[model samples]
Target chain A: MGTGFLDAFAQEYKQLLDSELRLLVERLDAPSIIKESMIYSLEAGGKRIRPLLLFATLDAFGIDPKNGLPAAAAIEMIHTYSLIHDDLPSMDNDDLRRGKPTNHKVFGDAVAILAGDALLTYSFEVISTLPNEFASADTKLKLVIEMARAAGTEGMVGGQVADMEGEGKKLSLEELDYIHIHKTGKLLKFCVVAGAIMAEASQSQLDHLSAFAHHLGLAFQIQDDILDLTGNQQVIGKPVGSDTANDKSTYPQLLSLEGARAALSNQINQAKEFLKKTGLNTNLLREITDLVASRDH
Target chain B: MGTGFLDAFAQEYKQLLDSELRLLVERLDAPSIIKESMIYSLEAGGKRIRPLLLFATLDAFGIDPKNGLPAAAAIEMIHTYSLIHDDLPSMDNDDLRRGKPTNHKVFGDAVAILAGDALLTYSFEVISTLPNEFASADTKLKLVIEMARAAGTEGMVGGQVADMEGEGKKLSLEELDYIHIHKTGKLLKFCVVAGAIMAEASQSQLDHLSAFAHHLGLAFQIQDDILDLTGNQQVIGKPVGSDTANDKSTYPQLLSLEGARAALSNQINQAKEFLKKTGLNTNLLREITDLVASRDH
Candidate 1:
C-alpha cells in the first residue's frame, strides 16, 4: 500500500505541484535576487500535503486534478510564504528549514520577508489568473475569499498571534485549540474546501470534507507536537524541542504526552469517519490518516 | 494655496485614514502580541500617501469618499507591511521609520515579521470584506486582482528585486524607471484604479485614470528620490542620503539633478494632461501634482 499509494500519488500529484511551482517561479524575471530567494524556498522540499489534499479532494469528486492545479499551486504558494516568514529572524529565528538555511539567513531578512510577501500576493494572482476553468465565476471568487480568510487575520495569522502571545505562559485547552485551528487547521481546511470548490462539490460534500480536514489538521498538529518531543532533528530537518525552548504551548504541554496521543487517535478516527461519508477513493486519504497517527516525526 | 491645500487635504483625508486605520486595528482579536506589533507599525505616524491617493481618486470620480474607505485602508495595510519588512535587520536594517523605532526593533524581529505578514494578508481580507455598498461582486474581484498584481511579482516585488540587484551598480535611466515603476508606481496606480473601480467609471475614464496614476506614480517616486538627497531628516522622518549610503540606484543617480528635475516636470505635466482628459474635479488632483513637484521632502 505504501509503495503503490506513494508511487501513484507522487507520480501524478507531486508532478502536478512541481510543474505548477516551476511555471509560477519561472514567471519571476530571471536573476532578480528576491525572485531567486522566493524560488529557492518555494522549491525547497516538502511532502506537498496541502497541494496533494487539494488534488485528492478534487479527485474524490471525480474532477480532473488538472482543473484544480492552479488553486493547488496557489495554496502551496501561500503555505510557502507562511513558512518563509515563520522562519524569519524576527519570528522563529531559525537557521534551517527543510535542511537548508532559512530564507532570511540565506537571502538576508529584507529579501526573505519581501519574497514571502511577494509569494503571498502572487498566490492571489495565480487564483485570479485561472482562465474560466472549473467552477463558476462566483465559485472562483468565493474560493479567493476563502483563501484570503484562511491565510489572513481570522485564520492562520490570528492563530500565529495567539501562539506568539501564549508562549511562555500556560494556555487553556480551549485557547490552544483556537490557536491550532486558526494557525494550521484553517489553511488545511482551505486545501479541502478550495479543492471542493474547484471540483464544484455539493454543499454536503464540502461540509464533510471540511470536517475531515479539521480533524486531520488537529491530528496533524498533535502529531507534530509529539514528534517535536521525540523525533530526531535529522529526521524532522528542524531542531527538536525548540517549542519547549520557546515555552510554546503545545498539545503535550496542555494534555500531557499520553493525553495528546489519545487526542491524535481520536481526531484521526473522526477524520476517517468523515472521509467515509465522502464515498470517494479513500485509499490515499485513509493511508494519510494512519500515517498521521503513527508517524514518529 | 499650498498651505490651504495641504490643510484641507489633511483635514479631509487624514481624518478618514486615521479613523479607518483605528477601526481596522481594533478589529484584531485581543491579547495577541503579533497583532499588537502590526498595529504599532500601522498606527505609527507617516504621511499616508497611498491612502490619500485612494481617497483623492475616489473623490475625483465624485464617489463618496466613505465608499472607498475599505480599499483606502487596505492599501495602507499593504504599504505598512512593506515598511515593516523593509526595516528589518536583514533588509535595510533601519532602526527607525517615521521617527520611531522600526517595528522589528520595537517588537523583536520574529513578531515584527509575522505582524507584517499578517497585515499583508489582512489587507486582502479587508478588501474581500468591503460592504456591498462598494460595488458588484465582479468589480470587487477585479479590485482584488489589480491589488494582487500590484503587490506581487509583476509589480512592487519585481521592482524591489531589481532595486536590490542594482545596488552599488550604475543603472541606465530605463532600468531605474522600471525599478521605480514596479516598486512604487504599481501600488500607487492601484490606489487610483481601485477608486475608479469602486466608482464604476466608464472605460474611457478608467483609461485616463490609469494614465494619470502611471505618471503621478513616476512623479511621486522621483520626488522621493530628490527628497532623499535634499530633504531634512526631521521633516522627511527618515534619514536623508541613506539611499546614497546604500549605493542604491535612483532616478537622480542615472539622471543629473537637472535631468531628474526635467523628468519630474514632464511626468507631472503628463499627469495633469491625463486629468484634464478625465474632466473630473481637478482641484485636489492639481494640488497633488503641484505638491509632488514642489515638496522639499
Candidate 2:
C-alpha cells in the first residue's frame, strides 16, 4: 500500500542526510586533514538505514522530515565512527567496508582514530544545539541523554564488548541475542526513540513505538545474519559467510537457517502489530520494516 | 596570603573528585573489562587540574563546590579518554603514563579503544542529565554545547591533529601556540567556563574568568614544556626530557628554556591580572595560577 511513498521519502531524505553529513563535517573549525578523513568515511556509501528510520518515523507523525536532519546526521556519524574503530587492526582488522577501503586503511590508524573520535564528539554538539524552532532545550537535553545511553556502555558499547568476548566460543541463542540487541539493536532503537521524542509522542504512543523498534531491531540483525550466508557477494560488498569464517555465532548458527528465517518473519510481524497499536499514520515505518526484513546488506 | 587556603581547597576537592571518578565508573552497567580499563586510566593519577579549576571557579563565585561535581567528572572523562586514545600504539605508543601501564598496555588495543569511546560518549550523557538541584535544563544544554565545542574538533581534537601534523617539524612559536591552545588549552578553558556557567556568573564575570583561564591554560602548557627537561622523574612519574627526546616542538625548543620560563611567568601574571578584574573571591584561582607558573611537573 505504501511502496511508492516509502521509496520517494527514502530517496528524498537520504539525499538530504548525505549532504547534511558532508556540510556538518565541512563546517567544523578543525584541521583540514582530520576533516578530510572524517568526510572520506562520511561519504563512503552505506544504506543510511538509521537516518531512514528516523525520517520515516517523523513522517509517521506527519512532521516535516527536515526536522530530523540534525538527528539523522548525528546518528549516522555515531554509526560510522563505530564502523571505523571496529575495522582497526586491533579489532576486526577488515580492509574493506561496503566494497571500499576502511578509514584506517586510507588515513593510517592515528588520523583515522582521531577522525573517529572527532565524529563521535561532534555528534553531541550537533544534537545539543538543534535550532529552537525544531526542539526545546529540554527536548535536546533529553535526546542527548538517550543517545548517550544507547551508544554508550549500557547499550552499544556493552554489546560490542560482549560480542568480542563471545568470539571463538560457542554462544547460546540467548547469548547471541544479548550481543546483537545491545551492539546493533540499541542504536537502531535509538533512531526510533529519537523520532518519538522530537515528535513529542504521548506515553502510550512512545511505548508502542519503542516496542515496534525493539522487534524491528531484532528483525534487522537476524536478517543481517541470514544475508551473511545467502547474500550475493556483489550486493553485500564483503565476502559471503565471513561470519562463519570467523567462527562467530549468528542466528543461523544458533537457530538453523530455516529457524533463523522463521524468527525474522516473526519479528517483522510483531513489529507491524506494535506499529498498528500506535494509531498513527505508520505506513512509511511499516514499509521500512518490510525492507529491513528483506534487505541484502 | 592564600597559601593555606589553596592547599586545603585543593586537597579537599581533589579527594572528592578522585572518589567521584571511581564511583562514576563503578556505577556504569558495562562489562567489567571495559569499566576496569576506563577506571584504570581515570585512576592513573594526574593532578586533577581540570576538576580543581572547576571547583575553584565555583568557590570564587561563592557556589557550593559539590554542585560542580558532575561537570568536573564529565571534563575529567573527556581528558582521560583522550589520553587513552593518544597513548595507543598507532599514536604516541607510550607504554607508561604516571608510572603505570597505559590503558592499551593493560587492556589490549581493541578494548582500550572502545573504553575510550565509551568514556567520551558517557561524558555528554553525564552533563546532559545534571540533576535539577545542580543545574537547569537550559544551563545543562549550554554546558553540553560548550563542552562539545571545547573537546571536539573545534578544540582538543583539532589541536591534537595539528600537533600530530607538526611533529618533527621546526614549529614557529605561533604554530606551537596554535597546537597547545587548541589541543590542551581548550579543555582547560572548558573547566573554568563550566564552573562559571554552573555558578551562573554574570556575562562580565564570565568574560573575565575566561580570560584568566586562557592565560592559565597557556601558563600550564609552558610549565609542562619546561618540566619536560627539568622535572624530577620520580615526581613527574615519567622520564624527564621525553618531549625533547621525541623531537616534539616545545616552548623550550622554540623559545629556549629561559625564554619558556619567562613565558610561563608572564602568562601566570597575566592570568592573575584577569582574575583580579573578575571582582570575585578569586584567591583560589590566583593561587592556582601561581602553582601553574612554578610547578615542576
| Poorest 10 consecutive residues by lDDT, candidate 1 chain A | A1-10
lDDT of each: 0.82, 0.91
Question: What interface RMSD do all candidates show, one decimal each?
Answer: 2.1, 0.7
**Where in model 1 is the C-alpha error above 4 Å?**
A1-7, A229-235, A238-249, A277-284, B2-10, B238-242
Q: Which pairs clash (backbone N, Cα, C closer than 3 Å) in model 2?
A: none
What's each prediction's TM-score?
0.92, 0.98
The fnat of each candidate, in order, is 0.55, 0.94
The TM-scores that each candidate's chain B achieves against the reference are: 0.95, 0.97
Per-residue CA lDDT of candidate 2, range B72-134, in tens? 999999999999999999999999887788999889999999999999998998898888888
| Model 1: per-residue Cα lDDT over A1-297, one tens digit each | 364775587577787678778788787653467667878987895888888778777778777777878888889889999898888666777888777788888887767877888889989878866777566667767888899889887888888778877778988999889989999999999998998887777888889889999999999999999999989988887688978987888899889999998999999999999999987786766776777777766
Q: Model 2 chain A, poorest ten-residue lDDT window?
A: A1-10
Give the Å error, residue B193, model 1.
1.3
What value of lDDT does candidate 1 attain over all alpha carbons? 0.82
Top of the candidates by lDDT: 2
